[model samples]
Target: MTMRYDPHIPDRELVQLADAELPAVRSSEARVHLENCVTCRARQDELERARERFFSARSEEFAAQVPAVDSSAALLRARMAGLASEREVPGFWSGRHRAALAGLAAILVLAAGVAWWMDGYRRYPLKPDANLTPGATLSVSREQLCSAPEADGLRVIPAALAGEVFHSYGIRGPKPRNYEVDYLITPALGGATDVRNLWPQPYSRGAWNARVKDALEDRLRTLVCRGAIDLYTAQREISTDWIAAYRKYFHTGTPLPEHARFFKDRPWE
Candidate 1:
């Protein structure tokens, strides 16, 4: 039997890898780890793609300001360059002048519904028992459970906490082999190792199980780090609904082979 590689590369390291900022030894180790780990490799790919997308979007905006090669183009270029250099911190959903709110609105709209399967990037079907972390309500900030690895929350929520999580979710009599107690945001992504991020995910159920979500978590972390998406957005997407997130990152409605559909026919039972 093949061993499942669950230990993940830290979120900060993944970002550093994407930015090519790692030192020689660390980079060499990370490369070796990525070569042996399919999930990490996929995450690295997404990070690279996200970085490319971010810069490409910025380039497109700059390209649009080229003044159409007119007679007064020199002055226009100077003005455009001046305009480009001014930086402004963007607020959530404000979309800024460079990005519109259409995508944000779409995520909100799609997040309200649950019928999307094998479709575009959308939230996943949330388990009836899924929940946020304990620290989620302490006014501590959402970044504790939302932003990937910025907090070095690499240690998973201990297994001893599973019973408490299951109890809180009202899942009784679920065998250890039948379900997995997992983090909603996931530790690899800076999700708190507390009750709020914990849930009883069924290994005995459908394609949308812990294994599938594990992949999504890493992918989302990579995207978040690369600025492809915001941390708040990724948190909202996963905590409320992960199926949509899975599709968004994996770009497939169908479950990957790692996720077993053992009881696909009776997911809720």
Candidate 2:
């Protein structure tokens, strides 16, 4: 049975009812009331259409305001003016001024890195030390020899098997100037016989002699091991004719005197 409903309720309340908040039976009753009441139904339709038109117009207006090129130019001018006012300074430079400075700093850093790399490459030239053969001659100046701390007071000459060795006895410096060591072999024994010990003094005595002996032993061992010479055969040859070899090779042609001797007949085990 259709029941008569109230007609005096506000259009606002009718709008809420039209939103489907009522129970099924109440919503059916409200629908019947809406059909009969033309005034309230017309008000609800007008509200819905007005809301749609207002939103559609606002969306179009917002779309028009979005920046094209001309709008961007206007925005840029406004931003510049805003920045100048915020800084309280007239004709203030903007972000565009810093671009050149940033570019210049990057260029300087790149140049410095390139220069550093070039300097390192120049200082350390790539060359092989092993390519220098034993017989390869070198002409060095007197200044160069004297200036070198390691070779100071010692002569620099091309002779076979002349080398240095570090030992516990240590080096006695201020060693006589221009006197150089030489290596000579005995023909009778097919190996190294003598090592020329040249100095600007008489023979080394007592403690100095012991020190010299130790130095010579150390030097011989170094030559055998590091220089890759035949250890046993060289020792045997040196023992046999070391004194004679020293006198003949070192003292024969030179005015400088020979000062030391090979201590044992066979020093190596």
Candidate 3:
């Protein structure tokens, strides 16, 4: 005999039954009722058939509208969709952009450290030592240095060596134009030719330079030869600290000697 389903079953419960959304007890009860209730069973079957027709028609319309998929991409995406686990990749040393950023950071840190260390490095207007002049080791007689028509025993260094020395002293800027690599004491005053005597001296903003020192050297030598100042006093004063001597002779810090007027009378002065 053709059996009936329950007539009292709600239309919502009938839809829920078709969708498999009812709880176990309710679903079992619905199954028992559906076996005997003909009207409700017929309604559920109609809803299921309508759902299938709707989906099939829409899927056919979508397929007609879209471009066809590449076979390889379809296969690859099918395989990827089946994968249950996923792993994340990080941007690290492997990535060029990340690596470049890391390298820039390292360089910045190194520059900061260098700046911090260099902050403590010795600065200038250097203090003069009283006992030893760096260049005053008299390899020759006082007569040879003092009486010679020109400077004696001053070594003329090659440009390459001069560049090396300038860089070694941490002096930077433009080349020979900005600096004069000169004797600490001029070779005319018993200064030696080695590195000890050679240093880079900057010319003053206006008149004073290595040339002015040449005049001072001549003046000192003149005073020494004339017995106005003893040769030892001249040598000691020039070598121990020539700038201090320059100040002393020029300063009205004490009474100026009558001989000091000779400097003012020079052609350039």
- By TM-score, who's the top model here? 1
Candidate 3 residue spans exceeding 4 A from truth: 1-133, 152-155, 205-209, 251-269
TM-score of each: 0.42, 0.20, 0.40
Expressed as tens digits, the lDDT of each residue in 110-209 for candidate 2 is 4554565444322221110122211121233323422434321133432232222101112233243222232222111122222332111112322223
Q: How many backbone clashes does candidate 2 have?
A: 0
Name the TM-score of candidate 3: 0.40
Best-performing candidate as measured by lDDT: 1
Clashing pairs in 2: none
Write the number of the candidate with greater lDDT, choosing between 2 and 3. Answer: 3
Q: What local lDDT score does residue 24 receive in model 3, on the 0 to 100 scale? A: 81
Off by over 4 Å in 1: 1-156, 258-269
Tens-digit lDDT track of model 1 for 1-269 = 99988687876798887657888799889888988998888887788688668765765576557553222434344444444433332444343743434434434444432222311111222353333343232233335444423432234445568767766665566554655566676554555666776666765445677667666776787777677787777777787658756765665567778554322111222
Better of 1 and 3 by lDDT: 1
Please, what are the lDDT tens digits per residue for candidate 3 over residues 81-187? 32311122243436775555555554555555445434322111132223222555465655665567763224465666556545556666534445456556666
Using lDDT as the measure, what is the rank order of every candidate, best first?
1, 3, 2
